[model samples]
Target: MKLTVTSSLLALALISSSADIGVHANTPFIIEKSPVDITLFVMSRCPDAIKCESTFSQVFQAEGLPEINPTLSYIGSIDETETSKTELDLSTTSTTTTTTVVTKVNCKHGPLECAGNTHQLCFREFFPDYKVWVPFVTTMNSWQPRRIGESAYAREVAERVLGLRQRRVRRFLSLEEEDAEEKKKELEVLLEKVDECSEGQRGFELLVKSVQNTLDHGVGTSCTVFIDNKKRCVVDGGVWRECPGGSTVADFVRSIKEAAGKVFRISW
Candidate 1:
């Protein structure tokens, strides 16, 4: 279906059990997730993506954040040798839980996206406590599609404002710049991407393929909203065609809550 956005927001609070931030692929953790997949794939510079990210921020702000189970892994692997996690005290009241399984948390916007995705991965690996990754991603997503700056520019902005550490941003940038004999290898060292050896050689070719695998399902079209793989449609031209009965912008959120019921939140 053609995903179109008018003005409503699909707020998603992903309260991942924070992962260690500094783990590398060579020394990666044995990450495992449930069979469910409630992933969101968008170009790093798309305005639609911003709507989803920022709108979720508004939702989280209004309803509050979800508390991570701590035992379950959000970004990193749950098979780590050490047991280290920040404790989050949450008032168990409202929760909006979707079918979030082993979803790929990635970006499709080019070099800026690559860096953004990896930076988020690193944050989950190193600094998973703050959970401001959504804000940071949304900050970069605000960039216009036609006009975008260099990777260094994104890195500087993230560090100066988004609070990403200088070194971590540099590492992601370095990964984005890696190449060998007319082949880009930046995706190889991305700490977050799942390592897939498709079509031989692990490079941008493979990473792109991995990212596309999920996006092919049609979430890449616009700020596509999915609650547990069920597409939520916002009324366009007075037609609510995506769901059983769609609603307008004001009723959009209400429909989600009414449909999803009891959404749980988790910051960082």
Candidate 2:
């Protein structure tokens, strides 16, 4: 029978899943007990920044961490004539558009105002769920970095909060195949599919290799499933590492559970 996965179940699965690395009583990262202030610097048009804000907001709401006061900043236009430039050779028939946008314009205080504006819009677009600490403004040249430093501290707190949220999501979405008979059948089918796919001359071999590597080196440690500086998904040692490139969400969830099973030892 097909089981329905709910958000609550998913959250629970994330929380209850055993980590390959044994859980220690001590926290690795220090999160201040009090609320932290944060400033996020972003570009209005950068998708990476937008994703970061969205993910962070999800995590923030998931974990009831202390109240955070965050400021979002955007980098504005820049003068191309006054700045150094690099040229790239392109094929005449290339269809790709190579448009360069200058973020820093002729502002006296540099592009701080532009940066703040861009960041503000990005936060609004991506993290509408979270309460915005900074309102939309044309510029913020007088913005202080010390505020941003505090905001960074708040961001650290948000990470831990998100972990708790992830746990809830996992639990809410856990599959109910506890019986040995059912589990064995599922495993056999999965194995058969793997074998069948491997025998074909498809490009799935590389993916299989990556899964195998993750099984070997990914357990009991914080593995980054996807990371692009600003955006990342890290699976803690005890948690399952979701497949980085799964064809479907279900496949991705299965991969994470499988990886966790191989690496973790469950404890109360």
Candidate 3:
């Protein structure tokens, strides 16, 4: 899936989404003031990706942290030579729909890994709040080797995390306002919307764009960490190495705060 110079340009053309000067709607939203852009290149089914994301989750959840823009770029290979189109069909008991699209991207794990990647992307699209989707993805990464790529498992974990969030909000609600049955229905609806996106044409488009971005960045390895568009660290063979500043959570927090200070002339 290595991309030559010609194939790289072709891969960029496959993206149907708009490309603004410095704006990407599909990627995570960056805070305008003092934001540190952090992108993690990963594969959904890779064990190293799980370990890398889990470590960064700790960094993100650390108390009294500055504004940080976190994004995930899935790792895959795009082959421009393939001209044949593959149809993605998402069928249910009541209806069936097919997405006719040609994707040259090939994931390292398998087709299931591609589906899992799309599921995470859909979750990020449906729930933009990092607090919600980040933890949900981290939890899903925990359920690896067995339930990594199953659609049912994706829905199950989404409900589980969404319920946890709803309960936290429920604690602030008055007893009269708390309706458990109504909350259950709302959760079901939200899950259904995400499921549709993950199993439909939008999902395929998202994956293609993600893989295109990965290739554009020349990210060939899983668990590669990029901060401020520069390679900062990487997790390979389940271990962190080649970190210039340091790989510890404290080191990353310090680096981010330093970067923020330089960007905004304010200390954290």
Candidate 4:
């Protein structure tokens, strides 16, 4: 039997099937429903995204995943449009015609960012296990904003930076080309073969829409944390100058220190 994986569905259950996705394939990164749910929606290239990702790496490592369940994802998708063109040559006695595919893309930082965002989304949606997903995020963010173009460079980034092999990062940019339908099948197991990649689109869009779905935007910040429609915490402001409280990296660190001091006092 085949499983239909959806964000809503996956949040409810994790596919226990053995699938190799990350450097640490032994760890499971399943998203279990817990009292605390955190999602950080930001542009792929935004500095705030980096801050949020970095902060999560530090805090999660110190406090563990259970203390602060975080979902770091892009806030937009690549707009895909296809147009067919026929060109005729009437030079000789016989006429020859050719049809071509044209694709246009607009990403937050550029095409590189779109590619990076899609790869991250693919991992989160399909290959999310603690061993694979967590390491991928922490490592990729550490060396991210890579130069645009080529899956080979991405594979290199994975190997050298994340210590992942070739096949491990193969699907990272699997949905880059125009034929997303075919690529989705080759990339994700549960998806059906079709003319377009509805499943992939949904996965990408779900994260994109997460920004509007939460109170993060109200605070004018990228890595703001929200729980039950309430603003919890946020990294320093990125583009939005008015983003509240947090400003620089040190400000965030200071806030942590303050919180820890309060905890120490309470403990005493």
Best model number under lDDT: 3
Please give the ranking of all candidate structures by lDDT, highest first, separated by commas.
Answer: 3, 4, 1, 2
CA shift at 243, candidate 4, in angstroms? 9.6
Per-model clash counts, in order, read 15, 51, 0, 4
lDDT of 1 by residue, 47-154 (tens): 555565555445434342232211101111111133334444467554543442232334445455554444443433333443455554555556533433344544
lDDT of 2 by residue, 48-109 (tens): 34443444444344333444444443333223433444555576644443455443232223
lDDT of 3 by residue, 80-113 (tens): 5524444445563354444544556689998889
- For each candidate in turn, the TM-score is 0.41, 0.23, 0.74, 0.46
Which is the winner by lDDT between candidate 2 and candidate 3?
3
Off by over 4 Å in 3: 1-32, 80-101, 164-169, 172-183, 264-268
State residue 52's C-alpha deviation in candidate 4, in Å: 2.1
Task: Count clashing pairs, candidate 3.
Answer: 0
Better of 2 and 4 by lDDT: 4
Q: Give the alpha carbon lDDT tens digit for every residue of 60-166 in model 4.
A: 45432333345654554334455655555667556554555443334557666665655555555544544455565566666645542234444444344322343
Ten-residue region with minimum lDDT total, candidate 2: 133-142
Relative to the unseen true structure, what is the C-alpha lDDT of residue 50 in candidate 4, on a scale of 0 to 100? 75
Q: Which residue runs of candidate 2 sit more than 4 Å off their true CA positions? A: 1-34, 76-268
